[model samples]
Target: MSLKIKKDLKKIRKYIDKIDIQLLNLISQRARCAKKVAKIKISKDPKTKFYSPDREAQVLRNIIRNNKGPLSNEEISRLFREIMSACLALEFPIKVAYMGPVGTFTQKAVIKHFGKSVISIPVKDVFNTIENKKYNYGVVPLENSTEGIVNNTLDSFIYSKLKICGEVILPIHQNLMIGKKNINKNIEKIYSHQQSFAQCRNWLNNNYPIAKRILVSSNAEASKIVKTESKSAAIAGDIAASYYSLKIIAKNIEDRINNYTRFLILSDKDVGPTGDDKTLLMLSIKNKIGSFYLLIEPFYRYKIEILRIINRPAPETNGVWNYIFFIEIKGHRKSKLLEKILKEVDMRGAEIKILGSYPEQLIRENKSNEE
Candidate 1:
């Protein structure tokens, strides 16, 4: 290489080395502080019930409020998540379970919301993860922009005692990826998760009308299948493509540009205010007339925007005769107005379960062409 190119390469190497050293120093400082905190926590609370959502929320809010930097609120939130995760690890590594075999959208949401430093435990099913309590938190897909609601996730709420602690909205970008050796040809089969297939229904019908659409267990699974199967392509995210070493045959193949999947973070304990917040509730009403409207009227009167409301059959009954309504409303449990509304809900309902209050969904500005 020329002398100029060589000097530039050396400068890049020096910059990387500086970053590595900085990271090491940061980690060392964090470790020392974590150790001290752990000791203090142990001495104060001998029972080892040291996890405090209220305290954590306060810390996060303070960080965000006091932040004066190029980093946006979302970036600051993510940074603090990792910091908190590391601190928590000092006391005890938090096990977070999410729906995955790894490289799935659920996993992406979990990492995005919790940060990569968190101990992520992938579970096969939603209920299995929630019922185990082996996980401090569980991330599960609740709804998608195109596919509507995930009934299975909603049903788990009725069976498991786990509460919704937070919410995450991950932008869904489905790509038609195939093995590197498998160039573009007469594609015989298209593989994807049932939900992914549904989301891309219009695109599939229009472009690959003759291709046999196969439903796999997940997007990751579809990618895995396509890696070995010739003349077959899979619909998955960029992460899955990287994992399976697949080439993107077609990019952003979803039916809509703004496709997004909403996920719920479940925990045994409720979350507190982080300044910005959202609350999820599961309400069961008496099968009497106008009971549903009566239950929702309080929220309307309070001027709380109801983001979503999905009906799932009460497991107690065999048929769809009895239904449990899952509702997502604005504001936190700590808000004075929301506190009063909760009381009103209690008086107006047969049963009201406060699923937990968590930080509001982070809205990222999309600059990509497809979006």
Candidate 2:
């Protein structure tokens, strides 16, 4: 209300307006530069791929390294991701396929990793769309920290020819959504994916003890069901709530505060390694007592760090009780040391298969879109 205060505010506003104009000009210049790069690349090779995971990771890492804080590293990275995504659209439209039906978390992952620029094709089976060349890439869940591996996705990899080019770990947030018909009434029943129900069982027990439970194919499906059923509530995330136009009665109801799901980016093109990379292996060892130890011995000898190890029962149709070991190790398989160790493992009568060697994602660094 003071004249001096009003004068100071006017001066600040003038400076901000000037800076905003300068920023617009700089961003336009960057986009023009991107266009030139794309033109030159296509001229050299007609089949030049637009998405380079390794290069993108390098760029983000470099930005973080050079960042001097006004905005956090993640804030800068997200802004740059949007910038790149826009520039990429100028080159060509990026098409991504995901396991979905409109409002699933996989779609959220698609938007999270690619920004809101790509053409998202949501289908029941992501692989089918990818195989049919309906999209440039596919996104599928690999594993969950709380519920474990997505067997369907892993099984698809068993026979599919797709390569894993990138990885993202998205935190899962379960929310309670109610429809307009019963906006303020207590929910009589609940619907959600089985995993979601399990993840939020404690919260649900405490809040809606008498509500009946109905399992659905996905959290998205639960959201859709709640849209039509007034007495029913859904446990899904932001995407579902927004798509279905539901109100969130509760947020972050998952049992674990740090639940995360790792999703793999599937492409026909193989990606080169980033310095910080992870190689995934699915191998069936010989049915012998010392086979397990012998398979992992090479890692110790080479001083290679093993990130994770998971065992699953192989199909029983072969008339043998076989086990498949899914091992994840730091560094790419292309490294000389890893190559030598893999060769030694083969010599030790262990068959090894490389699922992928991709840049390891810096998890929980970026704020999650969902629980």
State in Å the error of residue 212, model 1: 1.4
Model 1, position 326: C-alpha lDDT score: 85
Give per-residue CA lDDT, model 2, range 167-251, as digits (tens): 8888888889898888565688899998899889888889899999998899888888888778889999888999999999888
lDDT of 1 by residue, 1-371 (tens): 99999999999999999999998898789878877877897898764644555566677678877989898776777778787767777777767788888789888888777667778877877567666666677889988988888888877677677777777788889988888646655589988899888888899899999999988899899988888888989999988988889888788888888888888887777776767778888889877789888888988998999988888777666544777888888888778898788788788865887777877665542526223
Residue 98 error, candidate 2, Å: 0.6
The local distance difference test score of model 2 is: 0.86
Q: Which residue pairs overlap in candidate 1's backbone?
A: none
Cα-based RMSD of candidate 1: 4.0
TM-score of each: 0.83, 0.95
Q: Which stretches of candidate 2 lie over 4 Å from their true place?
A: 366-371
Model 1: residues with Cα > 4 Å off, grouped in runs: 1-27, 46-61, 66-76, 180-186, 315-320, 334-340, 365-371
